[model samples]
Target: MGAIGSSADNAAAKSFNAAFKRETLKGQKGWPSEREARLDAFHWLTRYNTRRRHSRLGQRSPIAYKNALPSTTIALTQAA
Candidate 1:
């Protein structure tokens, strides 16, 4: 936990931002409009969550790992 308004409170989000910049935004030509940017972000996020293999999840994409888990485990996690 971190104090309100502290950068530490956003450490995880910052890491994700860095990765998104590196993987999606950096070295790319800028979007022509806000709507284009929004659409690109949505596409990238969908690919990241459903297709990208995360090392922390044993090289499984998030959706794959979640789908592989037992129904009871999913239920318990959602209940929490």
Candidate 2:
């Protein structure tokens, strides 16, 4: 986390990051443009979040990991 500025980049250090990069760069060498990159990145993120397995998650996909989260809600008040 120290080397990277964003928490999201830090979180990307996990095992799932390997699978994500491999799948994205498998067929195409590189993206054509900003829009193309965005589209491809979105598609990969969706697939990874829904289907990629994780040993730390007891071999469950990230989607499963999220779905298993306890449903709790917290109300927020505006600062007026």
Candidate 3:
């Protein structure tokens, strides 16, 4: 684990946050209500997890990678 407030320890999370801010919150006027912002974030997260491709996954979205895994491998992964 990284020390508190250390970016290196939390690089992946920080990268995601930077992308979220850039992609989801960069330009538009602020949401009129907190509920709206929450809804937008939910939708964004859904799409990101299901559809966004990652270089480390050989250009597959996380859902695609998981789906492509063999059942036995998945079972072993879950068992662990």
lDDT of 1 by residue, 1-80 (tens): 47889869988788898888787676987778899899878988999889999999999999999999987734345564
Clashing pairs in 2: none
Error of 1 at 43 (Å): 0.5
Ranking by TM-score: 3, 1, 2
What's the C-alpha lDDT at position 45 in model 2?
Answer: 86
**Model 3 CA deviation exceeding 4 Å by range:** 1-7, 73-80
lDDT of 2 by residue, 1-77 (tens): 43567656666576466776677778777887989889988998887678978787999998888899999999999
What tens digits encode model 3's per-residue C-alpha lDDT throughout 1-80? 58888767888788898888777776976787999899989988998989999998999999999999887634345564
Query: Ten residues in a row with the worst lDDT in model 2?
Result: 1-10
Give one clash count per candidate, in the order shown: 0, 0, 0
Candidate 1 residues lying further than 4 Å off, grouped into runs, are: 1-8, 73-80
Relative to the unseen true structure, what is the C-alpha lDDT of residue 14 in candidate 1, on a scale of 0 to 100? 86
Model 3, clash count?
0
TM-score of each: 0.69, 0.51, 0.73
Q: Which ten residues in a row have the lowest lDDT in candidate 3?
A: 71-80
